[model samples]
Target chain A: MSSPLLEIKGLKKYFLRQQAFWQKWTGKKEYIYAVDGVSFSVNKGETVGLVGESGCGKSTLGRTILRLYEPTAGEIYFDGEKINDLRGDELLQLRRRMQIIFQDPFASLNPRQTVEKIIGLPLKIQGMKGRELSERIDELLEQVGLARVHRKRFPHQFSGGQRQRVGIARALAVNPSFVVADEPVSALDVSIQAQIINLLQELQEKMGLTYLFIAHDLSVVSYVSDRIVVMYLGQVMEMGPAEEIFSSPQHPYTKALLSSIPRIGKKNPSTGRIILEGSVPSPLNPPAGCKFNTRCFIKNKPAACFHEPPPLIEGAPGHYAACHLLG
Target chain B: MAELLKIKDLQVHFFTDYGVVKAVDGIDLTLQEGEALGILGESGCGKSMTALAVMGLVPFPGRITGGEIIFAGRDLCRLTEKEMRRIRGKEIAMIFQDPLTTLNPVLKVGEQITEAIRLHHEEGDLSPASGRRGFFRFWEDRRRREMAAWKKAVEMMEKVGIPSPELRMEEYPHQFSGGMRQRAMIAIALSCNPRLLIADELTTALDVTIQAQILDLMRRIKEDFRTSILFISHDLGAISELCDRAAVMYAGKIVETGSVQEITGAPFHPYTQGILASIPRLGEKEYRIKPIPGNVPDLGDLPAGCSFFPRCPYGQAKCKTELPPLEEAGEGRQVRCFYWRQIRAQREEEGGIGGELSFAGD
Candidate 1:
């Protein structure tokens, strides 16, 4: 395989929770295990889909990869360089090669700023200004399928899809090699979502961009990503080729999640609905041993499931699932 | 089968200073006994209004200005506020999109269910413990009724698959997770065992796994209770699994209505066709998700003719000036397009049933 463009090793993001008065007296330590010990690599010109339910730290992992959030502890290597130790001007230089697309279009762009300024800001910050910068901003707007008429208009003036187009334009302004698209289409309408998805695909092929696409929707991820990484609580439950994970999922959680997707035209729900017994346990107090043991559906679940955290073992070629039942 | 509810020429208008916002314009629908009908539409397409209008709870500045909402031979439109209140919970129960906002945050989830139970009992006209003759009056004999209601509430909590109902009943809405809160909302709505349940995007706020659980729970509820569900959602996939029939709405109008099988299989209307095409399906190839060109029309100032004509792929010259009345296409399916037949015929010739809809790529 060609060299991996972006790599994360044992990423651990923990947020300390303030103790209540009683808890403080009792001397309790609290930390929200957002992204706990996650390791993955994204190959050049390929999309690595990071799938998880909300609060599973999919967003946090993406943000941390982009250095938006200070890593609690981990190493992030981008384009064969260890970026964990980079700071000041070095970090800013690194940022030029990595860009992020946010979920909410309503909040991501400044309401007061015009589309021109919004898209031009990145280039301007990098010292490109005047006519040269203006032409590039116009080019980006066209690239993302937004009209030049919207150049003078603020974010509020455009529709949700248009605002997202503006967001894409801004992200691409820096000519970033890797993009972390964090639920880019989640907020838009279904029809409009396809437009953005298609646009992303077109842009990817054209620019030869690499993506770490993070989204809760598996169908969307499957459509875009080459590889799929499924997260539960704060750990990677399954990682493999997108098709393999979707078709022959090894993890019980992946099975449940995939089966849970309501099919479009199937008249009498052919597959058995795997309704998990309860919600995902709070990450702060995640269950011991296997994170999924509490709601596992394996008929002959072993005693080891409750007592031992399963390592991400190879289930198939390039496929890994963290489940004791496999053993 | 008895017609449970029928809405005829129903028009809901918001008389704003900017102009009359025609939210729901001349909609006609009929729901048979034990039928789950989905009102599928994009945001602001008046699907919620159709649900809220049935429940007689359309927010202020908006009023049901025209037509009849006849339920069980009683005209809901003609019913007084007092009469509507009696029918609201006892006969028809509705749940909003956001469970947290609709539910009472401070009250225990169990208390909410019990309150729904209590309201039905207190207002039940056919109960043997009559107000005129019973020795135990409502205020005087509150404890006896509450005890019964409490038991029923726990039963409801358990029915919706909330484990340990006894323990969960005491907990507030905030204590419950997102899925749990939605389940609590469902428990409250189903507690009274109403004839019809109006679920307005009930699973929209939930996670996919939780949504699947709730859908399964609803499916079970339908079979067990034989309750008719008016399921409203923007998700075709979720609704297709649950709804027996579906009404595709656009710009406050029902463009098409048909059996869920027919609707998902061969959608007659262009908007429905576009929507189904837009969604990125599992195992579907990248070529399938072609976004319908143009935006949904503004309800405040809809076009002179068809609201969707601007974005519709099959639009013709006639669609520019005259609004096509919703007519029966075939086999109980309705379509509002002026050129559906021609479009289908041409599409067939092209041999592209699942083909792209010619997205006027920007």
Candidate 2:
């Protein structure tokens, strides 16, 4: 296989809590392990879907890879270059090659900015000007299935789906090879979701764009992704091709998640569903070893699952799972 | 089986500045005792509006223009506000989508639950308020009843699968997580053991895993209490799993109604077929999701004929000229489409509606 367009290795991001007067004096601090030790790679023109429940650090991982949140440790290599060590103008230049699409199109776009300005801001920031920027903005809008006449309209004038198209147009303005789409279609209606997914797929084929699609909807991920990575409580649980992961999920957590998806047919009487008991454990104090050990339903769950973190082992060719069962 | 609730020709409309919106034009549904009826539709299809109309909880600018909501052999529409209030929590209850919005923020969870119980008891004639005029007498009786109801509320909370109900009861709404808050809402809704429960998109805001758990809990509760349910949701997969009978609503009309097996296995209506086709299933190598084309019609400016005519793939001249009444299409199946029979025959010839019937693998 060719080298991945974007590669993340042992990426970790922790936020330190603001210290109160007493805590400051005592030198005590707490940290939120939002994205800890998450590693994945997206090859050129491949869509890698990151699936997890809310608060499982999927969004944080997406943001960290795009450098929206600076990584606290580890490294990110884009096009075979270590991007974490870059600084100032060099880092800004590198950002032009990668882009991000936020979850809420309403909140992400500036209400005061017109559609032209919103889509042209990236080109303007990259030092394009005058006729070149205007022409590029129009092209981007057409590419995302929006009309150039909408360029003068403000964000409030557009519908939810239209606003998302504007966001996608802005993301493509810079001609980035890799994009981090965090729940891009979750906020849209079902019919609109299919439109956006089709648009993204079409755009990928047209531009050879690689996408790191992050969402909680398993069905959406299964449809869009070439490979899928399942995360739980800030750690990777399973990684494999989308077909393999959905058809024969080896990890217990993946199996539970797949079963949880409601399917339209006669109810299966014998396939026992694994209803994950208890809420996701707090990220600040995640359990040692397998973060999913508390919810694992396997009989004879190994004692090592609580004390020793299992490494990602190859369960099959091109499939990996981090569980003591695999070990 | 005795019918617990029967709604006929329900018409709910909102008087907006733009125009009079026919949100629920004409809907008919029935719920038998201990039966779970699922209302399946996309957003703006009037599924939730039907639920609110049944519960008499339509918001401002909206009203149940015409309908009969007969619950427990009583015409609820004819009842006075005072009489309806008495029956709301004692004989029928509703669980909303967002639990926090339904719950009081300032009050402790215990107080909120006990308040429901106290109101139910007062309505049931089980508690007679003292006529004494002093402030102390009122205060004393209120405290005594609250204290007694708190214990019963804790028991109800425990029965709904809440852990350490006694301890959690004293906590505020913010202390409970999303799933836990929903459980508490369910506990409060079922505290009086109402004969019918109306869940309006209760699991929409929850995660898939939590949604499955909630659906299972509702199923278990129905079997144990022998209560009927009006479960409304947009997820066909979820409704198929939890509901024995399913109704597909569109533009305030139930376009299709049938047993879950028939609805999911061999959907008759164009809208139902479109929805089933759009859903992504497990082990399906073909990932192309054929989404239903076009948007739902704006209620204020509905088309001259069928509301779905603009989007239906098989729409014809007849569909654009006259509205189709929901008619019996087959055994245990009803459809509201001008060309449903023709479409079904064509679908069978073309290999059964995008291979969904084959997916079931009979």
Candidate 3:
């Protein structure tokens, strides 16, 4: 297999939480453990889908991979070069090769700027000007299936789907080999979402690009990803090929999550659904041992699940799950 | 089942500066008592507007130009604001997509639920305006009723499966999580035991797991209360799970209406078919996502012919020139397409019927 284009090792991100008056007086420091210890890799021209619920640190992990959020600890290697020690111009060059697409098309795009300027800013930053930059902007618009007439339109004039197309155009203007699409289609309507997904796939094949697609929707992620990484709280609960994980998810958390997805015509829900009892615990005070133990629906769960943290153990070839019950 | 809520040719139009945007342009829907009816549509399709129109809560500048919202044997549109207010929450309650914003942030969760109870169920001689009494005696009577309403609120919280109801009741809306806030919203809506409950994308903002919990709660509530639900959503999965019958809306029109099984299993309308095909299926062998080309039609300036003509794959010359009436397709099924029969036949000839519409029909 070719070397992975981007690899993350034992990544961790902790944000300092604002303390109460008593805690402040006591000089107690508190940290919100966002992306605790997530590790994954994306091969060249392949998509690695990072799936998790909200507050599960999936977005934080994506930002940390792109170095948008400085990691508290761990290493991120792009093209086999460690990116942690890079600074100044080196970091700027790293950013040029790695781009990110945000979830909200409305908030991501500047309301005042025209589509031309929005897509042209990145190319202009790369020193392309005048006709060269304008041509690139038009080309990028057409590539993302937008009309050239929309070039002069503001963000407010366009629809949600159209604004997302503009966002995609801007992301590709840098010609980045790797893109972190953080819930790119989540904000779009269902039909519009499919269009964007197809657009992302087409762009990937045409440009031979790699992706760290971060989304909460498992069905959408499974369709686009070659490999899937499931995160809970701030840890990887399971990782496997898309098909294997979808068909036979090993971890209790993965099973419950997959089963929770309400399919269209699937009747006799009692036999299929494993409705988890409670919501995900606060990440700051995540449960001891298995992070999923609080909501795991497995009957007579092992005592070790509550006391001992399970390491990611390979079940099937390439399929790894972190759960005491798996043992 | 008895007819609980009926909307006939509802026309909710916004008289904006640009033009009259027909938000709900001549749509008809009926919800049977104890039945769950889902309205599946895209963002600008006016599904939510229909719910708001029924509740007499259509925002400013938007007026019900022409329509009759008959609820519990009374024309809601003809009723006065005071009369409508009595029916709004007591007989027909609606929960919105975002509970956090819909809920009053200043009040305690329990107090909000208690307000709903107190509004609909007032005790005799307890209200301050009931009669002239000593000030302290009137205050004492009011306190007694308020405490009774608070007790009912605790029961409502327990019914919605909220833990530590007494403690959580005193907490503010911001103190609750997204799922819990939604549960609190449901508690407030169900406090008065309404006959018809309208849920507008209730689970759209929730996580999948949390969505499952909310859906399950709704199902249980439907059974326990026998409350007819008019569920409006853009998600087919959630609609299929919660609704017994569904109506597919496009550009403020009901393009298709049928049972949930038929809508998901053997849809005839091209828009319904397109929506079904667009969603990525998990267990399917092949990825058969065929996105309907083109954006949703602009609500302000819709085509005279079929509203879905722009994006519909089976559109013909006649569809572009003249509108098609919502005609009966099968038993208890309606389709507003001129070429639905031909389109279904064409797909069947290609053997796409059995292979496609992969909603996990096993």
Q: Evaluated with TM-score, which candidate comes out highest?
A: 3
Top candidate on lDDT is 3
Q: List model 2 lDDT by residue over B131-210, tens digit each.
A: 56776887767766777788789999988888899999999999998888999999999988899998988888888788
- Which segments of candidate 3 are over 4 A away from where they belong? A20-25, B124-137, B354-358
TM-scores of the models, in the order given = 0.95, 0.94, 0.97
Candidate 2 chain A: worst-modelled 10 consecutive residues by lDDT: A263-272
Ranking of all predicted structures according to lDDT, beginning with the best and ending with the worst: 3, 1, 2
Could you give candidate 3's per-residue lDDT for residues B45-135 as a string of tens digits? Answer: 9998999999999998999999899998999999999999999899999998899898999999998999899889967622444354766
DockQ for candidate 2, C-alpha atoms: 0.55
Show the lowest summed lDDT stretch of 10 residues, model 3 chain B.
B353-362
- Model 1 agreement with the true structure over B1-362: per-residue lDDT tens digits: 89999999999999999999999999999999899999999888999998889999989899999999999899999889999999998889998889888888888888888888888776342133434445657664465567778888898888888889999999988899999888888888888789999999988878888888889989998889999999999988889889899999999999999988778777778888788778876854445687999788889899999989999887889889999999889877899988888777876787655333321110
- Top DockQ: which candidate number? 3
How many backbone clashes can be found in candidate 2?
A: 0
User: What DockQ does each candidate score versus the true complex, computed on alpha carbons?
Assistant: 0.53, 0.55, 0.72
Q: What docking class should model 3 receive?
A: medium
**Cand. 1: chain B TM-score:** 0.93
| Candidate 1 local lDDT, A139-224, one digit each (tens) | 89889998778899988988899999999989999999999999999988899999999999999999999999999888899889
DockQ score for model 3, please? Answer: 0.72
